[model samples]
Target: MSGQQHILEFRFLAEPTDVNFGGKVHGGAVLKWIDQAAYACAVAWSGKYCVTAAMGGIQFVAPILIGDFVQVRCRLVHTGTSSMNLIVDVRARDLKAVRDRLATQCVLTFVALDAPDGKPTPVPKWIPESEEDMALARYAEKVMEVHRRIDQEVSDLRPAGQDH
Candidate 1:
């Protein structure tokens, strides 16, 4: 509907040079596409430059091949004071295929930034409007919780007084 809405879709054909040595589309290319889509969605919602803060749960479900039509769908699932949690799914289908198959999925966090200073700025709050939206929002919360625990564990492992 509107650019400020929760969803953004990016569709394009997989190019010949996008493949890896195995003849399948490279994961790096797919990741780049996913990041681009997420960035677009974040900028649209925040109306400010947004930088990726973190990415998690990256799953490569299937391989993408050259000549397949690729689609990257990014959806805003939750929001913190200055961050937006987005779910990005990449799907691809051959020319004759009727439906696309999931190729990759990940959750990305982007933080809106204030210009000049490049400090984190508050983003517009996101409200779930449907059951699906609510479920996704809850899922994002769980993902963030796991990330927090992992971060804490990593921090605890560091030598005392060595923050770097």
Candidate 2:
């Protein structure tokens, strides 16, 4: 598959079961959707099994209310010899409103693997070709620093052998 072809969009209505007791859709539900969409993209791009290496920058900008239409969009923004960086966005739209608000956003890294031995396998190189693609690529590249900082902060919060 071509690099640009690594895109998948899924639309679903947030049912009552998806919400918490507070009446808002749970963040974990949206995160599961993000992972599902990202996995789809990775599999399509690599034509092989893929595993989630990392998922970061999961910012829940807004709450998704029950009865809202939710859209999960995933697109490949960058790639390495055996890895891929995908931008995943979850948006929510009111049943009666005209605009869809950004509910959640995250970046995921996936590593393609051989099905039989579960070894890392090569994937097609994805080169950003347009301004928007370039911007996404830059964001994918720059977000690593923030992820490292978050990891360090959490590590610092835990004592040497108390890490849980």
Candidate 3:
């Protein structure tokens, strides 16, 4: 996505400590990178402290071996009253192959927090100005639909009077 608003790009080199015995980066390590990237994007868009509410559709597509340089590109996909959806794409640069491959991808939901009580706080509405931005918003809407269905199924399975 090309725009002035999409603002979080972080780069780091994968060291031996970030990898596992199989010579690939650990799954948890990649998850941590995703969370950090998403958090930065949310905070930049909301201009407030944000905490992770949920994460969805995290899939590791390829292995990132040690010594590879990884880059995480994060963008704000949508915003609610107090929550925002951030999509992060992780890519590993293979110096040997002279190419970069997508390692993992995830959509992270974050809620702005009030400093006083750490409760949810209001955030600005996300206005999509371009076609690319609108496309991301549409994708986020689909993710929300899936989340809604999961919540509904869980509620339907609850015992009577214990529906919470």
Best-performing candidate as measured by TM-score: 1
lDDT of 3 at 16: 94
In model 1, the runs with Cα more than 4 Å from the true position are: 1-3, 161-164
- The CA lDDT of each predicted structure is 0.91, 0.90, 0.85
In candidate 2, stretches whose alpha carbon ends up further than 4 angstroms from where it belongs are 1-4, 152-164
What's the residue-level lDDT of 101 in candidate 1? 98
Over 1-164, each residue of candidate 3 has an lDDT whose tens digit, in order, gives 21235459999899999988898999999999899888888877777789998887778999998888899999887888999988889999877778799999978899999888988988878888799989988887788678778888999999878857
The ten-residue window of minimal lDDT in model 2 covers 1-10
| Candidate 2 backbone collisions, by pair | none
Where does candidate 1 clash, by residue pair? none
User: Per-residue lDDT tens digits of candidate 2, residues 74-116?
Assistant: 9999999999999999999998999999999999999999888
Question: What's the CA error at residue 143 for candidate 3, in Å?
Answer: 1.8
lDDT of 2 at 78: 91
| Model 1 residue 76 CA deviation in Å | 0.5
